[model samples]
Target: MSHEIRTPLTSVKGAIELLTDERYFKNNDQQSKLLTIAHANTERLLTLIGDILDFSKLDSGSLPMHFERQRIESVVTQAAQNLRTLIEERNIALEVLMANDLPDLMIDPNRIAQVVTNLISNALKFSPSNAQLRITVENWQGMVRVGVRDHGEGIAAENLPKLFKKFTQIDSTSTRRAGGTGLGLVICKGIVEQHGGQMSVESAPGEGSTFYFTLPAAPAGAPSTTAEASA
Candidate 1:
């Protein structure tokens, strides 16, 4: 991730340097457009770095979790909203279907949001334009299951088992086409596990894919704590 950020940072600096030159200023239109692209790439680099740092903290058991009862629907809604622009840009149909009776469970809202965002972002990347991404939350046997379904080029059978491995890209060529550091799902898995959740993916080639995770329901009359919850 650090290496990935440096490329964009270097590009942005170069673009800025050119923009500062008097000759470049005379042809500012094209230069300005390049600067815009550079700015966007810089933001992407920063986001990737943040994800890496968060994942590192999680792995080292240094990440802090503020556990409190939070409405599941609200968390899902917020995550979907965060990715609205990406969804629109791809012309994909993004839907959130939340069960009205979902219980307020103790969790770190930000971490949960990160999980949702990662899953949604991955879905958008692999999915065809105009395909649908469905996010659904439901209560099942005292646990909340959130599933992200994408109608994309589904994972190959040989690659399914390696999906969560850090820096392991199932489709190496597709990584460049998809435009990500490939650590997104690894980070999502670490976050969900820290929150006492189990994440799993179900997919077959050409059949689309669904990634679902389950978080245990808060025990009856039990107070929430920062201590890790068991999956």
Candidate 2:
């Protein structure tokens, strides 16, 4: 389905790109504005398509699970670093807090990284400029808990239950403004569940929000993937 839909979407995007080119539209102010709008919507369409593909994999249980021994501190730091450009562009402070002796987690590093990146990205999107965005890792009741906190316009009490639902939009006006497929949190929750973890959010209308998840730490003498593959 994506293949068929993307072909036409690509054609539309290509035309918009050419029309919006500054060199070509230099003297056509009205045309340039229209083309710019088209270009932005096209980009949003492409993102939506990508999100659909991800959600399909997740829903079908086809998303591959790669269990690895991942250091809690390093994984989230790298995820945040991967998004450093976005954070810096928005002028937000990015902080990662973890104890020096935190234990490694038994999980898929890449998928976990995706969750971290998504949470931080969402936080950055809603947060005010110059606000502090924090990613903290701590040991909680024998599990490793990671939280992404953002000082943004918090969600309402009634909307909490719909957060992880597929294609959920808390506010249509806000959705149109933000331009997301809304499958991100659903995919994040699916990944965490596949790893036997739990994902949740905490927020109030006036205060900020925190999205956090917990995963079991790798047990002592657990066979590492590298060694298992070799054997």
Candidate 3:
């Protein structure tokens, strides 16, 4: 199914690229508008396809985990920096607050960063320009909790139940504007669970939303499978 779908989608993407390129319909206003819609939807389709493929691998538990002792500040900072350009362009304030005594974690740095990035990205989608989105890391029980809070219109109670479900869209109009496959948070939840942690969300309409997840701290003398990979 993937192969069949990808074959046509690839052609559509290539065709849109040609039309939108400087060498082609760059002078045609109508074609330019059509090209914009075509290109955007094509990319959306590709994103959806990729999400499905990853979700399938997740279900099979075949996704590789290269856990290591990683520093929270470094991981969270990298994630924030990745979205810095978008945050600035949207005129939103992005803050990362890490507890000074936060512990090192036994986790896939890339995967954990992926979760942080996903949460922040979703927050950005709902956030009004000039609003604030903060990523907070702290000690939670025996684990480390990272939270992404966005001060926007906030989510409704009815949408809360569907927030982490695959392919679920909170609001059709909002989702269309946001331009995502809606699997970002679901993927984040799965990644956190793989690390023996939990992912949860708290929000109230007009009160904004906070998405958080916990990661177990690495025990003393914990070995790095990542290092083992090199050995």
Candidate 4:
């Protein structure tokens, strides 16, 4: 994990060093583009590092849970907002559908948001530029299910079983094209399980894919609130 992180940090530092050189800035457009790519990759690397560290803490039973009532809609919205740039850049049609009667759930909002963001990012990575990605939230028999659906190149049947394995990618070509460190889904699964929830995926070749997870619902008949929380 440290090596994975340092790779991007080193690249970012190199980019910065180049930008500081007066001669390098002479080609403004090229330098700016290089810097942008380096900066974005650096951010992605940082996020991956955080997820790995969080997973480690959870595995060691050292991660603390902060449970509080939170609006599911808000958490979903936050995740969407974080990826708004990518969605817009790719011209992907993004939608969020929430049931009118959805109830507040107790969870670590930051961690849940991370799971949502990872799933959405994965969807975007596999999908075509103009494909549609939909996020749906609903109450299901005393549980809350959040679904991230993508009209993308679906995963092969043989690869489904290994989807959540750490450092596992669907295939080498896909991993190379998508530029992932292969720990995103693994971390997502860990986070969901830590919240007493279940994460899963459904897909078919030539069709779309939907990644869904179910979290325990707030206590029966508990009062609902719209306050935002981190997940």
Candidate 5:
């Protein structure tokens, strides 16, 4: 499937890149508009393909989890940094708040980062220009809790239950515009659960949503994974 789909798509993307070059094509409004549409659709197709592959691996429980004791804040912060360009483009004000002296979590940092990035990307997609989104991490009881809060047009009560279901996209104007395969949240939930954590959400119509996940803190006197330390 990868070879059949991605190979042609990659070739097409390369072709689009060449056509978009000013040296090849003269600057004309109609030409530029058509190329822009092609470019956007190409990128969207690639993203959907990626989501499908990820969902497949997750469903089969074949996706790797490299467990390590690490700071949750560090993982979340790095994920947010990777999306700096998107945040600027959307004009969204993003803030990360971490509680002092938080305990390290036993998790796969890359997987957790993927979850954080997915949640933040979803928030950014629904958020209007200049909106605010907060990512907070703190100790809850004996677990480390992290949340991505977004002030956007919120989901309905009925739909909140369906958000984590596979291929379940709510029928709303904002959702329609966001354009996702509906696998992101489900995949995120799978990853969190694999790390012995739980994921949930809180939202209402008109009020924004906050997606939360909690992982048990690493046991005291636990040593960091040697692979992680060396990396």
Candidate 6:
């Protein structure tokens, strides 16, 4: 029911936001303000709805995945680059450190990218402006590992366990200010697990946080063929 309603709302919101552009409204300040508010709310609602749907699918073991042999560097780099504008706006220094000759992962590139994006987004949220965010990719214990490290107020020991829980926020005030439905990490963990990987985090109160996940590397000498899988 929610999705049914959200479909049309998304279309209407897109149209409304387009009209909110200065070139479209010329000197109509009042009209632009109204449209902008509507657009923002619409985006919020859409994000909430999408998160809820994704959570439901993940919990119900129905999320679709496409597994293929992909370079960890390419996927991680693409995911980080997609958020380049956001990082630049916050004056955050983004560094990507990839190990030499990392193994290819047998996973869903899009799903893995989504996981990377979510981790990076969370890191950016807690990190202060002008802080540094680092993404490191390397081969670990026969698996390919990707880690996102952020210089921010790190997660507490107790709250660390709750990081991947559904609808969980370590600090409500901080998470609310950062803007998320609290399902991002839950979904990310689910996606990684579905690909035979594990997600974990390391942090200290003031030392910052590093969220990492590992996926099984493609078998040695195996053919790089695409395959469809589902949770």
Highest TM-score among the candidates is held by which one?
A: 6
Q: What is the RMSD of candidate 1?
A: 4.6
**Cα lDDT tens digits for candidate 4, 1-231:** 557766867777676767756775664777677767766777767676776776676667666667677877899899999999999999999989999988668787877898898899889988889989999999877789999999987877888989888777776454578876567787788778877899999998868789999998778665544344223
Off by over 4 Å in 5: 1-4, 23-26, 221-223, 226-231
Predictions in order: lDDT: 0.80, 0.83, 0.83, 0.80, 0.89, 0.86
lDDT of 1 by residue, 196-231 (tens): 888999998778899998888777786755565432
| Ranking 1 against 6 by TM-score, winner | 6
| Sliding window of 10 residues with minimal summed lDDT for model 5 | 222-231
Ranked by lDDT, the better of candidates 1 and 6 is 6
| TM value for model 4 | 0.82
Could you estimate the TM-score for every candidate?
0.83, 0.81, 0.82, 0.82, 0.89, 0.92
- The digit string of per-residue lDDT tens for model 3 on 94-116 reads 77788899888888888888888
RMSD to native, candidate 2: 4.0
* Per-residue lDDT of candidate 5, residues 70-123 (tens digit): 989889999999999999998999889999979888888988999999999999
**Deviation from native of the Cα of residue 17 in model 3, angstroms:** 6.5
Per-residue lDDT of model 6, residues 1-74, tens digit only: 66586889889987887776767667477877777788888888887787888888899888888877778888
Q: Is candidate 2 or candidate 5 better by lDDT?
A: 5
lDDT of 4 at 199: 91
lDDT of 1: 0.80
Clashes of 5: 0
- Poorest 10 consecutive residues by lDDT, candidate 6: 20-29
What global local distance difference test value does model 3 have?
A: 0.83
